[model samples]
Target: FWDILEQPPGSYPEIEKQYFGTHVSLTTDIAGDYLIKLTVSDGYSVVSDTVTVSFYYENVAPSVETISAVYAIQDQTVPLDGSGSYDPNGDVMTYQWFFVSKPKGSNAVIDDPLAEVTSFYVDVPGIYAVSLAVSDGELEGKPYNPFYVKAFSLLGAHTKLLVNEDIEPQLLPYKERFVVDKTLTDDEVAKEYVLGRYTIEAVGKDVTISNISATDHLNLIKPYFRGWSENEIVVVKKGESLTFELVSPPTNGKLTDLSFSFAWSLNGVGDFSMQERFSAGYDFTSR
Candidate 1:
């Protein structure tokens, strides 16, 4: 503050301007919560205001509560229970089931998004780890894991065990009718084995027995097969007969160097024991 001023008559007036400081920019994280601040200023003074903002995330995990198991014969359709899952946030949820130890090329059974199955029919016999994973819009939950029942069948052995002229059996033609024998239903001799038709004579210790078939029925049949060599595991093209150790049953008696041979003659009555041929040196345990 200096003095009272006097102006000249033809005066050029000076203008004073007000200026604010810098601009304010805001940002947020995946949750979309934001803190905002405003700057107000003249060239000589500055001030600020505080504010907040909200944002949302779209992806979320799904929730799984329970699963149900349905039983079925091999190759028959079975229903699965997926009623244990829900989207709490009201988002849509997806479902999937899997066989963890499935054989090669069987993954297509459950890979379809449209394979709406409450239970999947199990045709092969084995232990299977079943799993279901679900997802909602914002998140996906952990998969529920469980075990489902399964069984495998011989290539061709069924209810009607077909015997050759020499009382030997062949398993190739009647595979579809064979059901896995959990109990010793058909033959005490082959109580724990899978069903297969063979044209071999019951050579060493096992006796030749009568055969029967189950028609349009859900029945478990105890079955037996002649020991197979590595070469006989599957037909080979220009390959030698295999001589691998027989995968012994849980019983003590085991067959080794088991090999398979085709019937050379349709006329001569083949040895019934030769139908399911086993090596001479291997021990076979009875269940």
Candidate 2:
């Protein structure tokens, strides 16, 4: 018999035991920690053992989080982030950014595809498709669906459209863009929520994001693994804290919730554009 320590005794929903008597297959929408106890006894003797399980059920592929459209000055170096990519096995490791397409007649290119963090310089005014792929080391992960980053003539335009891009697919930056594919949690601490932040460069100019707040209603699903099987499937669940800051605080500040976008106009180009990109939540321990 099995039981969840936090749940009423005998409240363990029936689950199929795996090949090993020590392991079991759980089929439930619930996600969290469980402490299972096993006891065996003959008429004359008895013995017992216990195991604590930090469990979460998720069914998903590695995903990338990022801004939809990026704006940069032609011929100038620009950073791209792919660090937001994630895997369930705590396996996702390396980040690889690619350009699905380049502007016609453009000679722009990403500095290094293998490097976790990289940059690029575009010399033409056109839309380019940029994508990111992650690896769990043993296997390569999926690339974020590609997004476009517009480039304008460096000396010609002081301001340009700040395209309202979606944060679905992040590439791989600083005031400089950032891809926090890494997840850090403090389970030791008993805190209600976990907060996170990222640095975003103002699209049209070199302004500083010293202190600003934003919200990301991004649909982030947390993933978890079971057993030690190399080929085992991953479990996923929709959860985690949203509403992060635009810029990582130089110091800690109580997190606040709000939905907004950053608006800016280019110098020579008088069109206005808005974008809202936020950092991922650090804690994934199902609420």
Candidate 3:
């Protein structure tokens, strides 16, 4: 005789005396534990034994979906969306977001690390790599590739003038201008100018200017003297000045003429008109 002692919730094979046999085979349609008992009798004596079987299904991890890249201005809050992630088992899932890498000196952090959607402020101007993973309470799934976020600054130029002679060099009044060709974020537009400075110093006999800006915001700024490349840039920050030296010191008892011309561009795009054309004549008779 064969009897089912315990079984999962579902219809299972039936055992009856009319269908009894020395050996019986049973199969279940559901995935769970099953217990069965078998007994044999010769007239007065009987022997019984029990067996247990179990079925298991593997759990699938959740799938993550998001954009590959994002672009924005510096100091702006970039949003991250991972609401499209789903679990194959229809299990409740949790979200986890983290930064794989970021620019040097950047302290950007996600607003809500465990939220399906979150955002972070770009502290520095550079590329930031971000990653996302989802948990179905059992298994965790990560995207095949991480995403990138790029932050850039608007174009800006600063012009400085230097007058050098027998006396200590003097830095004349200078001008600064920032150009906006593309749309700007609310924070950027409100501030009108980003926080940072670029400096260009003119040195040596050829009067070549050198880019001395500490940051990488300004890709290139070329200086031209009378529509020619001095092979240099003329830029300086507030409270700072550029120094220019003539090929030869002014001859005594003579008037020397000095002038400079240059054009600048931010991130190597859109040439800006020469901000200043400085020409001056000084008498070197005293020297």
TM-score of 3: 0.39
Itemize residue pairs with steric clashes in candidate 3.
Answer: 200-235
Rank by TM-score, descending?
Answer: 2, 3, 1
Each model's TM-score, in the order given?
Answer: 0.30, 0.41, 0.39
Candidate 3 deviation (Cα RMSD): 24.3
lDDT of 1 by residue, 31-50 (tens): 44344455565669877675
Q: Which portions of model 2 show Cα errors greater than 4 Å?
A: 1-60, 155-271, 275-287
What stretches of model 3 exceed 4 Å from their correct place?
1-55, 156-287
Better of 2 and 3 by TM-score: 2
Candidate 1 lDDT for residue 65: 57
C-alpha positional error of residue 241 in candidate 1 after TM-score superposition, expressed in Å:
42
lDDT of 3 at 176: 28
Question: Considering every candidate listed, which one attains the maximal lDDT?
Answer: 3
Predicted structure with the largest TM-score when compared to the true one: 2
lDDT of candidate 2 over 218-250, digit per residue (tens): 324311111112222212112211122322211
Model 2, C-alpha of 33: deviation from truth (Å): 17
Q: Model 3, clash count?
A: 1
lDDT of 3 at 271: 42
RMSD of 2: 18.2
